[model samples]
Target: MLAEVQADELVSVDDLIPDQAAEFVSQLSTVEPLPPDDDEMIEDETSENLVEDDSDRSRPVRENGSIYFGECRLLNWTTTAKGGMKADLAILDCPADAVHPFKGLLCGKQNGQRLRVWFGELADTDVPMQVNYQGEALLLRWSDDSVNGMNTQVMLDDGPDGVKGTHPFTGLPIGRVEGHRMKMAVWAINDDESVIDPRKVKRKVPFYQKPETTQAHLLSRRPRFISYVKRHERRLTRGQEIRADITIAPDEYIAEALYAILGITSRSELGDENAVGREARRRWSSLVGEYFDDFYGRR
Candidate 1:
């Protein structure tokens, strides 16, 4: 095609452009138009999906509101886990509300009902968000007298397990959960002020014991008390034993202390065929038991 402006001045080419001419432009290089940004993609396009599938890494988790079913000790944090303060309300009949929240992570059922979770500073490793409760479930409501200094109901995974807790009375290092036994938990208080079942109640946590002014349960078992006294004496002879705050030491009038604490005026009194000897034996045994409790704190 010829330029219209240049054709008008051309005398020789005027007849060649007799009819018409179409204008055309020549390319400087072979550059294509850039594709739309929406259509553009990286050389190595992504193949993985944004959402992930459940893998072995994923674990069962629990939370504050999680419910459970099992037989675990009801600890009272209201007074702190200083000693094993068991729950006076023994929930022997807990709910059989065993649930399998996750694979192989079932909370076993107990007697009466499933326990509602109330976590207080307990953590789970497998699932960070989900909660794995401190311990077991199931609750039976056996109401007793109202506890002293009773606090809120909840769960506590951290405790006197291993060498984690300190001794309440002696202020020494506690080696283990020495006096732990499973008991009932207080669930929810009935609005009507009526006694409710533990599983129905809705709380978690402990109880206490007395020995000084009150008689210890241990005294009821004469054989066990005698055995305990003997064992305690042996531990005293053992230089590096866990005898907490006992005054008498190894090879230091241990026998005398025993006799004095028991009030055994003579060894023959132990073999007393006479009623007088029997009375002395009884006196000494009782004294020795009291002494043991004095040093070892009531469980």
Candidate 2:
């Protein structure tokens, strides 16, 4: 009864080996030993899979491609090798669910750098163009050659993966571009208080504003402060005054600066803006005040 129960319970080859069944025991000696080294076997497998055609060596098997799913702000036009042209893009907003690891590639961790979009022969023209790779699409409108920046709403394609392409400049394997839509805005305030929209304007409208005296004062008083202000200057409205004192509450520039100085890289790290960012700004203001006090004492 015990043997019958054991036989019924056995469900796999492992159980049968331990049971020492007559068929398994008889077949053990006939089982051939594996080769000592598998290098020859591996070589044989590789040889069978490799393409034998020599003509295919002249060109890449797959073309290079990349999909950037974020708020890409056109900083300025740049000249490339052989007099080619490319737009410098600053990735403003990358989603948390972004498929690619684009943190450092989008912008440098320390000194920020813009991503380049090579226009090749099409640089001089003011035209709307489309760049599609691996289902990801970029609708670019080059109004004209000017410092006036532009922004657009982009949705990363989450479609079926396509043949990988090598980045022409970087020589890195470009994977599928996948992400969601992000908010983007770039416009200049006109003299008549009307906004110069990039979509409506056929030609690139130059973004110009009279330099505020307060801005110069802030620069003279605190040079380091300019870096922080420039990063978040988009938050300011037309003709918004930038205060010299850093004690302003709910200031985006101050909050961004505090995050940088404190080494808080991500928005997620800034838990509770009032608790983390606001408090840090307060402490920073106090520190700056003390520094000025010490300077006056030395004099």
Lowest summed lDDT across 10 adjacent residues in model 2 is found at: 42-51
**What value of lDDT does candidate 1 attain over all alpha carbons?**
0.29
Write model 1 residue lDDT over 1-299, tens digit each, in one string.
Answer: 11222533423311221111101001111112322323211121111101111222222121111222222333322225442322221222232342212111111222233332221211232323222122322233333223422112222223322112322212212221331223121222222322222222222111012221112222322344434555566443333333333334432343343444444544555555678556555655465555556547853
Local accuracy by lDDT, each model: 0.29, 0.29
lDDT of 2 by residue, 1-299 (tens): 11222444423333222222223223222212222332211111110121111111111111011122224433443333432332334444444333222211112222122221221111112332223222222233322212322223222212232213322123212211332222122222122323222111111111111112222222233434444354444442223444434555434545444445433443344233656655544544443344344436642
TM-score result, candidate 1: 0.18
lDDT of 2 at 131: 32
Every model: Cα RMSD to truth: 34.5, 26.6
Model 1 stretches astray by more than 4 angstroms: 1-114, 117-149, 156-224, 228-289, 293-299
Judged by lDDT against the true structure, how good is candidate 2? 0.29
Q: How far is candidate 1 from the true structure (C-alpha RMSD, Å)?
A: 34.5
